[model samples]
Target: MQAQRKMRIAHYGRKPVKIYGKTTQIDSSLMANTTQEEKRCSFITLNSDPLYVAYHDEEWGVLVHDDKMLFELLVLTSAKVGMDWTSILRKRHDFRAAFARFDTKIVANFTERQIASVATNCNLDLKKV
Candidate 1:
């Protein structure tokens, strides 16, 4: 059996339209015009900070099923306790560098000396797991 095709919306200009039948269907007259207010009110607001807002909008709330990503978030969130997220966010690069990039197999093998070294650093507030 063949899978059924789903109808999709296409944008001729600014408006979302669905082409149906022999005649091209214009979904609405509103597509030709858009106001700044309308744009701002869109589901995903584009008017945001390039760095912080982009990460928040794209990756912040998105679900993660990958083990590496899960471990990274875990380490980051744990390291962030009693501290501001901004500080943790800023030091994320350093954390990756120091922690071997959250490789589960590698971090799982960390010795007490390794954990102690990372915890003593001014940049990281590592906790012994």
Candidate 2:
């Protein structure tokens, strides 16, 4: 779908708005009256962070049918016990290696020694897993 035009609450000239007890000019020419859906589609989110915006635009709320992808998501989610999503995304490669590339069978068959190795070498929080 085509992205809607971006809009901001800008004001100027004769129109003064009370913002935080300060009088600010409101620019009516740039004002936009958009539907909720249009606003949502225009930007990934209200967040201004580029990485967060990219993540929301590209992967947020998307379906996963592939086993590998779902497994990756599972590991990522599990690892977010005390960490944030940006940290988890940055550590994706470490997670994949720690979890045997997220192969369901391989991960399931991890030996005690392998588990220990992962705990020692990776930043993963096994307590959460």
Alpha carbon lDDT of each predicted model: 0.59, 0.66
lDDT of 2 at 76: 85
**Runs of candidate 2 exceeding 4 Å displacement:** 1-49
Q: Cα deviation in Å at residue 115, candidate 1?
A: 0.4
**TM-scores of all models?**
0.57, 0.60
Top-scoring candidate (TM-score): 2
Q: List the residue pairs that clash in candidate 1.
A: none
The CA-based lDDT of model 2 is what?
0.66
Model 1 lDDT tens row, 1-129: 011111111221232233453544544543435443332313334554345444554466544678988988888888878886667777888878768888989988989998877776634544423
Q: Give candidate 1's whole-model lDDT.
A: 0.59
Model 1 stretches with alpha carbons more than 4 Å out: 1-50, 122-129
**Candidate 2, 3-119: lDDT as tens digits:** 223433111112454667998664454545644334344444566456755665456655556899998998788878888788777777898888878899998898999988987
Model 1 TM-score relative to the real fold: 0.57
